[model samples]
Target: MDSNLYRLFGDRVRELRETRSVTQEELARRVQLSRASITNIEKGRQRVLLHQLIEIADALDAKPSELMPSPQSQSDPTMRRDVARVVEMLKSEKSRSDK
Candidate 1:
């Protein structure tokens, strides 16, 4: 699979997850995946099966296609930054919860 495609998909997942205020751990639990697996999916380091994609989308109250980035949006730097921001926000939330 192409790295760029992976990135695009990952970003879309992260964005939707964040919009729904779902943490990685919660999503993982709902989807019956490990936290690491959720992290890998969001980081674009691991590929997801179609069934898993459907599960994730459902957990986030979204359609499967909503978890995908369009080719035009994939190349958009603003979209990447937005995803990065969501990651940072998640990290901050994690740290707060840990404390």
Candidate 2:
């Protein structure tokens, strides 16, 4: 799939975020992400993982379904369940790619 699909998820993220009147820093703190990351997602520059989406939703008193692409449609099944592992792998991949 094209990255645009992830961009589509960004609007939902921004909506649930602003609906609660929470600051980006607060949301990022709750999710263990950087404010820049929250900005990126809200601006359609990065796609958040399922866990982060759920955390953000909870912080905003919303549902994960309220912040995600679709309840039935997700990024990847296994990666969705184990975000830490996937994040580490992605970091490793990035390091390797950057070399």
Candidate 3:
């Protein structure tokens, strides 16, 4: 997965976990993973495998797909253009600052 996509998925997982009032430690135990693993996933520092994804979704009482961002939303042309514009603007700012 793309880094941005991984981050988005991680954010979704965090949101669902919070909504279910589940702590990271508790979820870690349920999923048979370490709390650090959960933290890393929540922070987008780790990637989840298919089995882990299913375990997480099951623990949260959510569908696996619910842990993912909508493809359409992520692929929206307008959003892509906006992100590109922001990237260009940041680059321009950085170049000016470096000079």
TM-score result, candidate 2? 0.62
Q: Is candidate 1 or candidate 2 better by TM-score?
A: 1
- Pick the lDDT winner: 3
Indicate the TM-score of model 3.
Answer: 0.72
User: Per-residue lDDT of 22-97 in model 1, one digit per residue for the tens?
Assistant: 9999999999999998889999898987667767877998766677677476656566456445545554565598
Q: What's the true lDDT of residue 18 in model 2? A: 81
Count: clashes, candidate 2: 0
Please write out the lDDT profile of model 2 over residues 16-80, one tens digit for every residue.
77877888998899888999998898877886665566567667887554554553455564533
lDDT of 1 at 38: 88
Clashes of 1: 0
Which tens-of-lDDT digit does each residue in 1-99 have in candidate 3? Answer: 367766777888899999999999999999999999999898888998766876798799886667766656586546545543554555456559879
Give per-residue lDDT, candidate 1, residue 17. Answer: 89
What's each prediction's TM-score? 0.71, 0.62, 0.72
**Over 4 Å off in model 3, which ranges?**
76-99
Better of 2 and 3 by TM-score: 3
Q: In model 1, what is the error at residue 6, expressed in angstroms?
A: 1.3
Query: Clashing pairs in model 3?
Result: none
**What is every candidate's alpha-carbon RMSD to the true fold?**
12.1, 8.7, 14.3
